[model samples]
Target chain A: MQIFFSPFSPYVRKCLVTAHELGLSDRVQLLPSNANPVTRDQDIIAKNPLGKVPTFITDDGVVLYDSRVICEYLNEMGNGSLLPSGGAARWDALTLQALADGILDGALLARYEDVARPEALRWPEWRAAQLDKAQTSLAHLQAHPALLAPGRVDIGTLTVACALWYLDLRFPDFGWRERFAAVAAWYESFSQRPSLQASWALPPA
Target chain B: MQIFFSPFSPYVRKCLVTAHELGLSDRVQLLPSNANPVTRDQDIIAKNPLGKVPTFITDDGVVLYDSRVICEYLNEMGNGSLLPSGGAARWDALTLQALADGILDGALLARYEDVARPEALRWPEWRAAQLDKAQTSLAHLQAHPALLAPGRVDIGTLTVACALWYLDLRFPDFGWRERFAAVAAWYESFSQRPSLQASWALPPA
Candidate 1:
């Protein structure tokens, strides 16, 4: 198995963390990629028209993409219980994953606004609105503490961990910890898992 | 079941279309929303912190969201076969959905640049690069004709159809039909399905 890798992409990190959790990280080789929104990468585009990182290739030569699909494929391959099979557990986990991904989506857009778009054309309201998604999401988690209960790890929590990882990486001074103490407390503990702590890099060419 | 509705959100449309396909549209109520990227909607933010359309509430009071999860939930609720159970078929269907969703993402970004953002703050290069995603994706589909095989109306094909629908609605002059005749031809035939043809609107209050 192989996955196109970009060290900073939260989506790529989500997949790698998922692979690590399932003990399939050793089987999934990382292929360096340059996936960008404005200066799109043709190399990655050749395999995934979206030109996004974390595009996966199975041992049977099948291609899969977008972190959600790749993570589920890894789960199935490893026979892991990261994703519940059915019922409310499945919906709740999937929805939590969506919320986390939504936070990352907003964070990435804000990051792009801050760095990718030219300064003269940047929109402050847009950037703030993007980060507001993370703010609102963290507030939601803080209010509904059961959603992030201690020691509960699954796609939902893992994806949230990845979202928080990106938040800290990009918005160092966003200060979510001060406002969402419960979420901060949950993350402080949950992020210690080996999978969340693990990092990946491309092998020497 | 109820879903937050935005007349023009392709994600919302995807869920409605999925419900229509499963003969569950009648059971799903549409709740009006003004979901926007810049001015977030508090009503939607109350249930879904992401403040996005297609946020769904199940009869059991469970909330589900983002089009992918809602579509899958609708499929399971209606016992539809939009998503395969497992195997390569599932991955392929999902990856195709991801590709179509990616196209929509780029298109939405371009749309926001055109209308949502102020003209003085717009970056032509940013908009062009966003649309380029759709161009490259169409080229990929044109190259791999089998991916959009005739009469195969799973989630993948349905999503690609929705992407095409959005392109026609928003970028009428995108000229995808002229550039990728095979994709255009396939869409012409496939879109005649009742699911794609059905139009959704909030019931008179």
Candidate 2:
């Protein structure tokens, strides 16, 4: 299978981390793509109408976009390690994953506004709103730190780590560490995992 | 199962429409909530940390957010009616759902910037960028009309219809009708369905 990915995307990192965790990294041939959201890539757009990263093409020639779906598909291929079997625990895990992905969405939008728009057109309030959403999500996750346990390393924890990593990358001044000490500590420890350590390497753009 | 939902949210509507179509609506009790993103309600936040609508609290009291997950659970309950069994068709259905959800996210962000942010903080360029994403998504869907055929109303077509309805509510000036005449007609026909009609009410303030 071939995975079309971008270096700087947290979504791609989530997929890579999941693949590594499932011991399926060797099965995926990662192909670099220049499909930035601000600048359209017609070829990538043709494959994925949304033109987003982490587009996985299965060996059977089926294309799948969206990191969450790709991760689920990969998990299915590897004995369903990342997702829980059923019931409340499964729902909580999936919901938590959605929350973390929501944080990434907010952070990405804020970054795009700052970089893609002219200085005069940049809206501080908009950026601040996105930051508020991210902070709110982080606070919730911190209050429930068990959600980040190693045994519970489902899609949610993986995504939460990536979201926090993105915040550190783009908004170092946000001071998330000061306020979200528990989450920060959790990430500090979790980032040491071999799957995370390997996937967390900064892509040289 | 109880579904906490806002009538106006396209995400909520998607879940409700799917439940009704799958004959699972009777199992879900709809609870109303005013959980605006800017002033997210504490109660809703307690139910869903992200404070998004269409949060499904299962019979076992597990809360599920993000329309995709909620719909999947509902489909599973009803013997996997909405989603395809499993194959390339299933991947296409899911990828299409993600694309439609992307359109809704962009449109909502554009609306939030105008309504939630103070007037002086509104950014026309950011709004334009979001509209461009939505338009591009619509154009792609328009070109592939087979994706929205009747009796084939999977998560993808349902979400695309919801996205079109949301655009009509928030961006009537985009003239999507004239440009994407086929999609406009498709949505018009789909919106007349009983399930769509039942879920078509506006969000309460």
Candidate 3:
């Protein structure tokens, strides 16, 4: 399978992390692709009209996308170890993934308000509103530290780690580490996983 | 299940539509709520830190959110008929849902550029960028009208319906109907489904 990806995208990182966890990373190739509002790659857009990264195409040529769906597909294709089969456990993991992905989405929007939009058009109130989502979600994770338990790095946990890592990369001084100690501590340890270390996004140019 | 919702949100409409499909509409009560950048409901925020509507709480006290997860939970809680249980059919439906949901996300962001921001802050290019997502996705759907098959109203189909409906509500001049005749025809007929008509989102106040 080939994944159209940008190392800078949290969503793409989540996909790569999930693949590595499932031991499917070697079976896939990553095509460095920039898919943002400004640099919409036509080839990537052909595969995913959304022009979003984390668009994965199976060997059979079936295209799967949006990190959530791709990760689930990878899990099912492999051992399904990342996500439970049924019951509350399943919902718990899925909801955690949703929360983590929400943080990435919100944080990205906040960053765009600063970097993508023209300086005069940048909206502080909107940026603050978007930042609140990441802060609040981080606090929630801090309250539920059990989600960060070792050996439980499913798609949900991987996504949360990647989202926090993206914040450190893009908004290093956001001060979430001070406000969300437990989550910060969890990140400090989770960052040591081989999958995360191997898939670390390239430093900004 | 109780869903914090605003009638104008396509995502909330999706949850309601999914519940109705699962034959659990009455079992799921809707609580009118506002969750936006400017007006964040603390109650909803506590349930979903993203402060987004369509946050659902099950009777057993489990909170699921962000429409996709909640809809999946409702589908499982009921018969699971609305979503295919496994195999290629399942991934097809899910990928379709991701595509349609992406349309809603982009369109909502564009709408915010106008309604949520001051006139001076309104960025026409940014709004156009967002609308292009909806347009591109809609065109994709139009090319594959099989996705709009009358009997296949799964999560994906339902989400596409809601996204287009939202465009009509918030971006009436988007001219989707004129650009995509097949999609418009499909929408014209699908709009009459009892499930859709019953859960029609109210006109924006």
Per-model TM-score versus the true fold: 0.99, 0.89, 0.95
Question: Runs in model 3 with CA error above 4 Å?
Answer: A200-205, B200-205
Candidate 1: clashing pairs of residues: none
- What TM-score is obtained for chain B in each of the predicted models? 0.98, 0.92, 0.93
Best-to-worst ranking by DockQ: 1, 3, 2
Tell me how each candidate scores on DockQ against the true complex. Answer: 0.93, 0.48, 0.73
What docking tier does model 3 reach?
A: medium
Maximum-lDDT candidate: 1
lDDT of each: 0.93, 0.80, 0.84
lDDT for B114 in candidate 3 is 81
TM-score result, candidate 2: 0.89
lDDT of 3 by residue, A64-99 (tens): 888888898899988867888889888889989999
Winning model by DockQ: 1
State chain A's TM-score for model 3. Answer: 0.93
How much is the lDDT of residue A117 in candidate 3? 87
B-chain TM-score of model 2: 0.92
Q: Is candidate 1 or candidate 3 better by TM-score?
A: 1
TM-score of chain A, every prediction, order shown: 0.98, 0.93, 0.93
